[model samples]
Target: MKVKCPTCQNEVEWKPENKYKPFCSERCRLIDLGEWASESHVIKGESFNQQLTPQIDEFSEDLPPADEDFFKH
Candidate 1:
């Protein structure tokens, strides 16, 4: 089957051999990545980013120190 590239609307073949499936070329894939990196693409809804960061830091601090036995397991 064939599908249009999400970035450039070029036709692309849907196949296992096509590494950049859904994109016509590497250029189109990278362009999509750039859009994501620049925050040009965002999901609409509630954001948990602000709430989870401090919880992660707190959890990491609570972890026990690693010793030689840690690797043996």
Candidate 2:
């Protein structure tokens, strides 16, 4: 079957024999990679780095203290 390249919209064969499957050539594949690497292909708001840390309620006194058993030998 034939499909269009996501980067250049060029028609390409959807076969295992093509090293750069889904892309017309290595250049098109590399072009897509470059866009991702340069942050041109972002996935909307709230980045991955920001999601890693959970938000803390500053005035919430209902939280428990750190686990004391964790540091015990």
Q: In model 2, where is the ten-residue run with the lowest total lDDT?
A: 55-64
lDDT tens per residue, model 1, 7-68: 87988999999988889876576556535544553211223223334333332223233432
Clashes of each: 0, 0
Query: Mind sharing the TM-score for model 1?
Result: 0.52
Candidate 2's TM-score reads 0.52
State each model's CA lDDT, in order: 0.54, 0.54
Task: Give the poorly placed runs of model 1, Cα more than 4 Å off.
Answer: 40-73
TM-score of each: 0.52, 0.52
